[model samples]
Target: MATDFWASTHYKRWIVDRATLRQARADDLLYIDDPEHLAFLAIYFAEVVGKLGKKLRLPQRAIATATVFFRRFYLKNSYCETDPFIVIAACCYVAAKAEECPAHIKNVVSDARQIFCHEPYNIKHFPSDNSKLAEMEFYLVDDLECDLTVFHPYRTLLALCKSGNGSEDASAQEEEAGEVGAGIPADDGPRYWGTGQGQLELPPNGLQTAWFIVNDTYRSELCLLYPPHLIAIAALYLTCVFHPATHETVSAVLAASSSAPASSSASTTPDPPPRRSSRQAAERKKPAQDPLEFLAELNVSLPLIATIAQEIISMYTLWDRYKEDSGSVATPDSSRNGEDDGPVVTPALLTVVLMKMREARLLEIAHPSSGRPVAVNKMLERTQAAG
Candidate 1:
């Protein structure tokens, strides 16, 4: 991991242009008739990867990084060109190592096979051999250009909490709530709340919701669009707009935690406050500014932050409608459901992918000579057998 994000490989190479990303995705769009379905497929694959990582007891950092790896891989190479499951497995294997909590190739393969063995997806017998996983790992690394370190918003959120900007007063919050109307606008753009500037404090409930929004932002292109700290600010800002709470909530919670240790059975004893050090007293004497005040001072654009927040909101909206089988209407918590929410990985989709892979393989094998395309039924049979 680079000490300076601006000087790191993530900043130098991975932050891609929108047009460039769009052009790269064009290849995948060609094969996938319904682009929306393909997006759902990517989301499904990310969920599986996350689950696989968790079952192995890896940290959320590793899982989140692995999910980003999977998304980045598909961005460069289409699902039809390579197997999604193998790529997912490889990403998990590499991300575990990258995040300093390594998982062996054998463990990755076995755990993955065990997890998805009876799942709805066509994956019955995935790559169990360590050698196979290692090979796919090489491909994943190459696709990401060996940029393994990913800067997540987890640390940024923690920094905000420590800075005291993670909680806000009720009067300040209510005013914000009234201005924005809702978190995001019903139309395409974001509605600017009074002067489009404020102290930018998030209450405990708002902070928690912001944390959820940050997690959900991983499912969108915001990670690629902006820096980690900016994303954190955006999530908190959106939380305050959509669901505003007061700083007293967090203060009360902290007070409860501190007071709980003194009393037996934790009854309301109105625990006495502890004596503060001179340094602590001095620190408190200074005025507290917005935790994200530094962000405002920097060259960061408020409009860009708002746009990133809007995009994440849009992704959640799509996620609600992503489930084809359930036909459930989208609620705010729709994404909290299990993997069965979206469209299942149909054999037909796999078959199409298999046919494309076969064609590419044939082209590689018969470089000097021409050969006819393989039959669909035989190709499907071969794909199933390989799995």
Candidate 2:
């Protein structure tokens, strides 16, 4: 795996522009008119990945990787071309290997059957044979171009928080020592967020909140459009905005930190530094830096971060309007089951669209003169039959 994202296949080949991503989905959009329908499906499947990963005892990193794989596969292929249930299982199986925590193929298929066989899906067509999942894994890898190394935002978020905390400690020490012009140099680049800017203090739940935001971004096309680090920063930016540090919040954070357990080796270590007087401590204390200002000073493209943030916000809006029970799209005013509101998209509606896509695909295969692009899996099957 490439350590640097700049040199990784994710940055080079997978980071698509918005217009290009839209164009890529044009074929699928022909069958499913409302693009939000697709977004809803993506969100639904992401949750499926999470649930299955949890059941398998897979790490969050592997779960995230599986979700990305599922999304990437659909970017190139239509939903009707292949069974999404099989793809979901295949993605999990492949991601486990990619993350060096492989799950048994039998276990993956069994768990996936349990998920898709109930509720809104009630999918009876799910393949019972383990070989079906094994076969789909080949197509999945082919679609991904063997680019299995996905860099998630979790690590980047932690790194950012760590650097911010380190900078705050250094700033306080420098203030106490009466150092002149003491801080990260301007030439230190984007690695450190506290360079020249004031110190950043994350709220008590800021990092945790940012983590959830990052997980949600996978539901949108932001993962395919922007780099992981930018998405992480955008998540952190949203966290700071949503959970700003008030006096009470800060006091709670201080209290929690003070009550944390000391290191086990503390008794063996020497710590004889003279305690600072309360007056001296008060003089060294500095006001927490505004996270927004700190982020603004970083050497990154603000416009890109803003765009990513907007995309995440849009995802949340879609999630709000989604209803898993309804099979068809409903108008806002249409009341169902005594409910005043209706969903914009539903699994039933997506199922109808997929059925149309499948019917169209059958017709195209029967009449090759239609000139529509054949799904890769179909072409492979045709080749095998010819042989």
Candidate 3:
């Protein structure tokens, strides 16, 4: 397995541009009118994979790897060309082995069936034969080009946290100088980092919230569009934004720093420099650095981060409007029933779109004289055969 993500196939072969990703999905999009429908299906399947992973008792790493595999497969091929239910099972099986936490093929199939049998899915087409999953695993590996080693954002998030906390000595000095919480609103108390003293700390649930965000990224094309580290940074950024304490602390620090020069110049006669301890002197020169500051210092593309952030925000909007049984737009509350726990895209809807894709392929295959590109026709035939 490649420990360095930069040298791995994931970075070299898997990271794709948005245009390339969109072009790859052009064929599938023809069958499904709304592009957001693809996102809805992705989220629904990601959750399904998560549930199956839990049932199999696989670790988070394995589950994450499985979700990536499922997404990567779809990037190369459409749901119409393959049954996503079997693909989900295959991904779980393959990811387990790749992560060195293998699960039994039979157990994966059984667990997947149980999950598909429920509410929105009501899927009766899931293959009962464990061999089908095993067979699909071969196709999945081929589609993935055997790049089974997946580096996730979780490790990167942890590393960033540790590095952020390493600045505690400096942060403590700022706390002593009464500069740590300067300019912060009264309501924005130090809920996460402890009265703005010591190191930058995530709120009680900040790390978990970021982890969930990272998990949710798999539901979008982020895994394919950006590197794992960038995704980790984006997740951390969102975590800080969502948590008032962390967000305010960073904002206050930046706001204070930006206004420092103006405030110092406005004074007619500045007070003499105070005689103070070395710690205080150091604090005077360097204020407490929050996670946001740490993020800003990193050598990364801010635009890319902004783009990923926007993509995630867009996904949230799509998730809120997604419904299992309908293609029409509806609010989150309207989509849910009293009995249903959450919204899900039914297999029946997926089946309908997939059948259309297959029919189009069949028509293309029959009429070689049609204007459709020969390459597309052959590709469709190959996908149809693989299915």
Candidate 4:
């Protein structure tokens, strides 16, 4: 795989537009009701993968990569056609390999079986058969088209924060706390690099907050819609809006925005202007600038970044609602057939997927010719025993 993100298959083949994404979601609606349901299930699946990774003591990047793998797999295949729980389990195994943290298939299956013990139907989801997980691995790999390298925003954000201009040098701090003004020379600010001191640097926690924000963005389509660096910029922009120490920076930038639109667009850079000839373009292409200067010159859309921030924000809001409304407690003995009759504290997304899995398993048992479905005979024996 090409290590360069710009030239990678992720950027060229996987980064998709919204309308196309909407159509894909529509196709998956056989199992999911609407866009809201799809997003809710995505959040649940991410949590499942994360919790599994945490239990295994895997790094957060590994968990994040597994989550991305799960999402990418569903983008191509319907969740109903295949068992999401199994796919999620397989993703953790494959992601462990992809991230240089190999996990044995048996251990992965064992962890998942214990993790999802509260599965509604008790259909023995996350089967212990190592072969099942190994077989699912093939499907996951094929559906993902063997593109495993995920470019995240974490490194990009770190690079921006470490730059001298991006963060103020120690010597400049003593000049003035927050009242100093630095002006652009005749040719500086958005096209020209400025040596002045007025540029804003993020607070101590700004980088950390931006990192979390980028992590949360994976719950949505931001990873597939925008490049990693732009997502980092959006996180930084949101940090400026929310973090008390960085408020003044956003205020200053907004105040500056009234005069020109440069800073607002820093989060979403536009393409370079067209050139007459390849030779002329090669000759005129400017040398890369430091991160700060690049930020200043970027032609990003302020509104687009704002929209991305809002998407992350909305996911959190939904998360809170799901937790509050569902109480989010799991019970192994809870009724498996349908809703719990009363206030319905169980999350609908979880409920829906569980029901679908239960139904698919029943269909397989009723029609046993369907190539060794997860324990059809055992499930039938249970029904006979219960009856």
Best candidate per lDDT, number? 2
Stronger candidate by lDDT (2 vs 4): 2
lDDT of 1 by residue, 1-387 (tens): 355555677767777778866776675665554676555555566567777888888776677788888878766665554567777788888988877789977788888888755434446667666777776776678778988878776655553443233235433433322221122222421222223234345444655677677777776666676777678778766765565453444445456667768776667676576567866886778444433343455345778887887887777776675443323223222344455445433423433444455466545444624455433323223333444
- Give stretches of model 3 more than 4 Å off: 163-201, 270-286, 323-387
Per residue, candidate 2 scores C-alpha lDDT tens digits across 1-387 of: 466666678878888887877776676676565665666777877777888898888877778888889878877876655566677888999988988789999999788888777655666677778777777888789989999888777656655563333556545423322211122233543553535343345755566677779878877778788777788889977785666553345455556556555554356767566567865886788654545566778768888888889888888987876666634343323354444434455555555555566667566766757576654566335322311
lDDT of 2 at 380: 33
Clashing residue pairs found in predicted model 2? 327-348, 327-349
Q: Rank the candidates by TM-score, best first.
A: 2, 3, 4, 1
Q: What TM-score, to 2 decimals, does candidate 4 have?
A: 0.67
Q: What is the TM-score of each candidate against the true structure?
A: 0.65, 0.75, 0.74, 0.67
What is the lDDT of every predicted structure here? 0.61, 0.69, 0.68, 0.62
Candidate 3 residue pairs in backbone clash:
none
Q: After aligning candidate 1 to the native by TM-score, how far in Å is the CA of 375 from where it should be?
A: 19
Backbone clashes per model, in order? Answer: 3, 2, 0, 3
- Model 4, clash count? 3
lDDT of 3 by residue, 87-110 (tens): 788888998888777898888878
Q: Please give the lDDT score at residue 195 for candidate 1.
A: 33
Q: What's the ranking of the predictions by lDDT, best on top? A: 2, 3, 4, 1
